[model samples]
Target chain A: MIAKELFKGTIKTIVLKLLSDQGKMYGYEICQKVKELSDGELMLTEGALYPMLHKMESEGLLKIEKVNIGKRVRKYYKLTRTGKKEFGLKIEEFNNFIQTMKLILNPSINQSI
Target chain B: MGLSDEQVDYIENLLKENGLSYPPLLEDLLDHVCCAVESKMDDGTAFQVAIKEVLNAFGKDGIEKLQVQTLHLLNQKKQLMKRLSLLTLSVLLFTVTYIFAFPIDPPNSSPLKGNAKITAEFGMTFNKLKAQNQFHEGIDFKVPLGTPVYATGNGVVTEIQSKSTGYGHMIVIKHDDHFESLYAHLSEILIQEGEEIKAGQLIAKVGNSGASLSPHLHYEVKKQGKKINPRDYLTP
Candidate 1:
């Protein structure tokens, strides 16, 4: 199992990508989706996920819709236009970082030293 | 296998009892906890056991901590910055008054040999990379590695500490009963704890240590256990 510290920086990127792909997701749904995607290897705790969602909402990257189920209210988060643009920027940056790491970790594959 | 309205009310009441007062956070947590409990009930678990397991998964302080953490993340860069800037302004006013009332005297000496470049100032400033506003307690001098560090006052070395992070390799000196000076992020500590130190005496050497990214000395002065601006005391 991977250490949770390694996942800290990637949490925001993962949330942005998820919202971009899934359109709208509630807190629990995001957790379940992450778990499913990771094949139960990752769990996004409620403590970590809710604060980040609220922070993103305040940052104008995400908008919320409140739906009532019985007596309880569920908040669904969807990406804004800025959020979509941000996802593109972040994904590009992450891909570049991955490529750099790959070159360092596996230099034997490349012809150039 | 869904929770009844009464069961939902019980959970909501529990959240409120734990001091969760924010509306948006309250709503999100309420729904999330209910969903978790309902899913467990569907798998043949009792409602009591299910709710306990759900709250346990939230870790210690549970619902109460969620609201505090959410508010902190939202408030940090915006509202907190505004409040901190106001506080800094008031503190600056007090420091100016204190300086005018009684000037710092002969015990004061420059911590460095000659004119050194200051990389960061002592005051409230916003760090864009960290996305936070911080009150820098000390003045940071941008110097080369292994640069000699001096004691600013006649004092006894009271503490010498070495750590991997945060004020790593630091020394604290007690001066004139009410005043204390600190030097942090050192590559070498040349003085021993409890050793008597004279003004301008060599005590350490600057280096990139602790949470620092570059070689520099973080020097601070405190009066009666409160950190005051060292800029008020240092000579040119």
Candidate 2:
């Protein structure tokens, strides 16, 4: 099980990859998707996710849209062109890093691979 | 089982009363709390109880802690930008000062003060028993064992010899007029070969090292490798 502290660093990469794959997603939907993908092992609270999203939008990596859902407005995030390019590079780098971590952490599993 | 508009406004006002005034985080927290309470009601929990549990998840500081953390991150970004700009400004100021300070080289003064004897004069036959018949290149000044020798002009040090048979420890400086001067038989050389020196700059100390009868300085000025008399160039 991955800890929330460990997920903190890769949250940007997670959002970038999610937006690239799903086109656009609202804030609640993104948190639910992360939970579902991790088999409910990882949880992203509202406090952490919103600040990261706002920071990304400020950096021009993501664009936001508002949709009227009943009486409230839901904010949806979509990747910009720069965000797409960044996602491609970040995933490749992250995958290589994960493989190196795998070798160090699970040497017996590394023998078979 | 979505929350009513009245329920959303009640939570927002409660948050505002408890010091959650940062707007963006406040709005997002309100949405989060409303959704969580609605979901709990759908699962058979009472509305007020679910709201209490959901708000409790944000801890005793409620939305205030998250707001502080987010603002801190933005402050760090602002501080990093300020430091970078300050660094660039300092570098610019340094370059301006350096350009303005460049033309003040080669101080104007005589090399030696009026206290030493002219041991050997330039351009006539000067013999010390073994050095037969040769025109002396420059005036020899007989100073004490460790008398300070100075640069006679503003120039760069062209050569230095730590131990040569002819002149024990020596330094040669090239001046602005394509003229090079030599200070030889020095007991100690205080400047490096490539260092810029001004007139009256202390360069070495006098010693007896080369073909000489007593402790003295061997000074010579040359142009295009030919020796010139230092007497025509310097006053006493």
Candidate 3:
């Protein structure tokens, strides 16, 4: 499981990138996608995911539409135009962060594992 | 089969009291947890164990962090509102005090008697005089110069003099109740030697005649000849 503190900042980016690529996704579907992408390594609890989604929606970064699926009403979230721009910026930042982390984590990586 | 309506209502009320709205996302999350707990119970899991498991999934620090953020925002708004109210109240209080309680002085009690109805009020001080130290003695009320200044309550006129002192023209009324009232920087005097007058009666008018800053009646009251805070006696 990912450390809670370390995950807070990146969660929004993760969600935004997934929605940007997938076009639209409901809550359960997004959770399933994350599980598959992480190869079951990263599991996001509903408690954390829903609040972030709601916050992003409130901020106008995401738009929601409700569809009646069988007996339940499912809410699907899609990225807005502003969300697309933000997604690009976040991806760039994340890439830089990953490179920095890799350098710090394995300074002698060029020599051995 | 699930949590009672009363429990849900209780939780909702708690959130409301904390100035948090019931957003749909939080509602959906709670509903899912409740349903999962119910399912576990149906599968022969103990109620406490199911509840513990569901709460554990939320993570101890996660819920607390979210609550703290919400509460911090609420508290900031509340503090700003409280400060604004206090500022408005202080301005209102100062206005009322300025209108009602003007011209306070030696610092003493008056033996003569008369009533002052506060006609016009303003403030005066020697701030620009470059004196070693200065303080505002009283608020000045404009009535008429030498308009027979009266005692605020029952007090005797203890000191009466006319010279180039701080108060060029002044009258000190001493009261029998160990209180004194002072009227200073006057144009003329109306009452005779040791005479008594009733409250609200004409004593003197506003004047610009003494070490006077402007044309206004300077007034003061004192308990035991000691200047008490005049603001405490004025009515709102």
Candidate 4:
């Protein structure tokens, strides 16, 4: 299964969690970490990632800090208080949804799918 | 082989010439592209060839496509903001129009519009009891002493006076269209100068207080400081 198709509409929640756990991360670092952690199965595109980052930054859920990195400026994203709270709720909601889907898809003892 | 400042500038100039101008997005994309190209060159890839590989991996329109997507998102946000401010602007316009529209009363609602009664006629030749032959420029209303007299139209009270002689306890209201209405021989004046008076509002009480007058109201309508017969503009 292609990860991009499976990962639609969940970019903000994912980014929020990453920023919450990792503190501050620039765009390139985020792509490398996700690729490494997913074992190259989930690849983030610039088209998807940058737009989400800009939108969430506009929404006040994330804050941006620009720093001089070598020859150019690099922008880092970190979760705000609202972003951390949102990430926590989204994780709990996703866990409940997964449990409910599992109960329906793999019911036992004559509870047919 | 990390790309130098000049190489990064060259890449940025190339992308800018390709129509990517939003600053924050441009900076972020440029740094990422530069990092990718430099890392590939570290593995002995030729500089130009690595740059080509990174740009190709950026997809068909490359930086232009990403710029377009970011602009589209910001445009959606701008439209939402315009909608919110539009609601606020509409509410403000309604309130201003309402406060402005408050002062003007309806035209046919005047007291003299359809129900005027004249006790003494205007422009009457009164034989002089003194020297110059007097022409009565106003009409008289034969109401009882101290009866409330209504304003003929809407206006501001421009003048008021109480005297034992001519035009006693009088009120003069300045109306629109160069018109002024005077209510004289009043037993009591009920309005102040600079106070607004509505059509048919009680401004005085009728009484005999002026030169050779019975218990009545001496009413006058003037245009440009000249007294005109009130019957010319009023209906019975």
Candidate 5:
């Protein structure tokens, strides 16, 4: 389980990175993507995800479009130009973080046995 | 196997009182919680117990945190408006003070020599009229009755009279640079005798005075034995 503070800061980066790759995604779709990528280890509550998405849209980092899907209107979010640039920087930072964590978690694996 | 109409109504009213509009995001979260509670009730749990479990999952602090963020955003907007209003007010105050405190400069600095023309016109004109025979000294200001009269130059107050025989309420400021200013026919005297005064320090309000016709201030600038026209040194 991810610590709340860590999850709070990275949630935006994670969403932006996913949208960068996936073109556009709705609320539920984005939640599903996070779960799948983390191999069911991460679960984002709707309570947390929607507010972050709304805040990002207000901040001009994301843009939203609404589409009618049968009985309901599904709101989809896509990265804005600024968001695309931010996504690149965040991905690089996340990759560096993952590499650092791997080194710390299993120092023996990279060293002579 | 669902929330009864009465329960849903109660929940909706509670959310409304909390100031949340039924936006899609909020509605979806509420609907999911309601469904989860209803499912538990259908499986033999009591209504109250199921509702409690649903609320626990929602977390008490989480809802409050969201509400606080909305209120904080509103408070920040109000603070910005207040700051803007204060800034505008300060600017207006500074402009008014600057206009009154500084003497109006003439279009061109032309020189005047020996007892030039001066008019003791409006508020202090009565005092000028009273002194017309007895050396008819000083120029009068044609300003509003209550306009704050300021010192003509830096000086020390020689006399400040609340009520005297000739000048009614008045002030006499003696300047270091060999000049004396006499302000008479005042509605109120603001300074004290022998107190140091600066140019543009408020000395009195304009008023009718002893042997006068109407409200006005009697202003005099004297250097040695000469009664030069006060207007020569003043800007209108």
Candidate 6:
């Protein structure tokens, strides 16, 4: 399992990517999907997930669709135009960061000097 | 496993009581808690046990802390707007009070329009008709009948009295909380009570209407309701 501190910075990128793939998802669906995709190695708490989702909404990165199911209302979030553009940039940056981290962690002897 | 309406209501009320009353945040938290409880119930846990487990998962004051954190971020701009509005209102109130209560210019001009002669001064003097010493409260200006009487300062006309006795046909103008001026022995009043008066504005005509031997204007100045000498404020 990843520590919460490490997971914090990646939440927006992950959410942007998730919404891009799934189109739209509510709070619980996002949490359940992350846990399922990570094979129980990642957990999204209500405290962490909702604030990030709301912050992104306020920043115009996501739009909400509210639906009534029986007596309860469910809020689903989808990426905005800006959010879609951000997703592509974030994915490339994250990929480059992962490659850089791998090089440092598994350094060749010639490069280590 | 889905929650019943009553169960959903219970979760909502719980979140509201714990101080998560913001509607959007409330709705999101409600849906999440219901899903958590329903998932737990699907695993064979009883309804009561499922609800407890879901709440405990949020940790202590976790629901409340979420709202506080959200509002802290959202209210940053709103708080500034509120403070600016309060400051604007205070400055407006101060400006209004300063203009009305303390005029930029003090009462300086004499209440007479032409050559003025002092027949009586403020303080004790002998009244030959009554043949006794009388404490005169105002300075008496000996002006002919139909002479114009003006307001000494910018103020509101607080009172107008018409009588055939002492200080007859008087007009009182309150300049501020600290100062008020009075004009008496007038034949005709040109302004109404509560009317705004300006300095040197002709407000009345001098007459011998009260208990007097000749036509004169009786003027008095009071500081905080106590009679003070009018000569201090009236320019010669």
For residues B38-107, what per-residue lDDT tens digits would candidate 1 score against the true structure?
Answer: 9999999999999989888877786778888898998885786689899999999999998877555334
lDDT by residue (tens digit), candidate 3, B1-236: 65566644543453344344546544444444556566678999976787668667666555555555544544566787799999999999999897666433322222123344443333344443455445666555655444555556644555776776577677776655455667777777766547675544456545676665566576766676666555455433
How good is the docking of model 5, by CAPRI class? Answer: incorrect
Candidate 5 lDDT at B41 equals: 88
Model 2, residue B234: distance off in Å is 38
Against the true two-chain complex, what DockQ does each candidate achieve?
0.54, 0.31, 0.12, 0.39, 0.06, 0.42
DockQ score of candidate 2?
Answer: 0.31
Please list the residue runs of candidate 6 whose C-alpha ends up more than 4 Å from where it truly belongs after superposition.
A109-113, B76-236
Model 6 C-alpha lDDT per residue in residues B114-140, reported as the tens digit of each score = 569998899998875588999889899
Off by over 4 Å in 3: A69-72, A105-113, B1-21, B30-56, B59-236
Per-prediction TM-score of chain B? Answer: 0.54, 0.52, 0.42, 0.50, 0.43, 0.56
Task: Please provide, for model 5 over B1-236, each residue's C-alpha lDDT reduced to its tens digit, 9 standing for 90 to 100.
Answer: 75666777665565555455647555544554565566788899987787777666656665546655544544566687799999999999999998777534321111121132344432233333445434557655555567677777776888777664577888777765456677888877777888887666666777776544667667776665356556666654
* Model 2: per-residue Cα lDDT over A21-80, one tens digit each: 899997778888999988988787767887788777766789978766565666778999
Task: Give the RMSD in angstroms, all C-alphas superposed, for model 1.
Answer: 22.3
- The residue-by-residue lDDT of candidate 6 on A1-113, one tens digit each, is 99989898899898998999999999999999999999998998888888888888877789999999778999999999999998999999999998888888878943866
Model 6's CAPRI class is: acceptable
Cα deviation of A88 in candidate 3 (Å)? 1.1
Give the alpha carbon lDDT tens digit for every residue of B147-232 in model 4.
77888778889898888887877888888657888888888777789999888787777788866457877888887788988777
Q: Evaluate residue B179 in candidate 5 and report its C-alpha lDDT on the 0 to 100 scale.
A: 67
Query: Model 1: which residue pairs collide?
Result: none
* DockQ value for model 4: 0.39
